[model samples]
Target: MDRQDCQHLLAALGEYIDGTLDEELCREIEKHMAECENCRVVVDTLRKTIYLYRVEAQEESLPQEVRHRLLARLELEG
Candidate 1:
């Protein structure tokens, strides 16, 4: 996949993981993931991060450095 495709995949990642995306968009993301290992790794890692955040975050706090790293990786911090 080209850079543009990777950008689009990243843009859709949150909605895709949240199950808010329609099937067509999910299919497109899945197809792109099949062809793009880099994107796949990013998506897989981010998805896991989100899962852990939702499931365990409420019960316990993350290490400050780990949370910072995750936020940085997700581009959520400026």
Candidate 2:
């Protein structure tokens, strides 16, 4: 986190966690995470949260109002 490049890492973090980042970029992120303990924790927590959300999402759908609100908040409404 102390490194200015942490911003670059953060920008690509979602793709990194999703396993969709290009190989060289992924390598850079991995190197940053190795040195930045704070970023590592943040990445780990987000990954776990996403995993749990996917699991719960499979078990039950959100009510329509809630779904709309959530999607709107995420700017993902389409």
Candidate 3:
């Protein structure tokens, strides 16, 4: 698979992980992942990160200052 194929599959990754993908697509993704270590790592990390976040406490909102700082950092990096 090429970069575009990876990008398309990446968008459906959550559904793939949840076992909601159609059989043919799931097979294709499995084949792609088996041959691509980078995609495999991304999928694994996303699953673990989501699991960690789900176990964390719920928060209604971030403080304004923290949000501002985060946005500033993201902008700088971007």
The all-Cα superposition gives candidate 1 an RMSD in Å to the true structure of 12.8
Clashes of each: 0, 0, 0
Clashing residue pairs for model 2: none
State the C-alpha lDDT per candidate: 0.89, 0.91, 0.84
Tell me the tens digit of each residue's lDDT in model 3 across 28-47.
Answer: 88898898888988889989
RMSD of 2: 9.4
The predicted structure with the larger TM-score, 1 or 3, is 1
- TM-score for all predictions? 0.65, 0.70, 0.63
Please give the ranking of all candidate structures by lDDT, highest first, separated by commas.
2, 1, 3
TM-score of 2: 0.70
lDDT of 1 at 59: 88
| Stretches of candidate 3 exceeding 4 Å from the true structure | 58-78
Which of the predicted structures, 1 or 3, would earn the higher lDDT when compared with the native?
A: 1
Error of 2 at 34 (Å): 0.8
Q: Please name the candidate that would achieve the greatest TM-score relative to the true structure.
A: 2
Q: List the pairs of residues colliding in candidate 3.
A: none
Please list the residue runs of candidate 1 whose C-alpha ends up more than 4 Å from where it truly belongs after superposition.
61-78
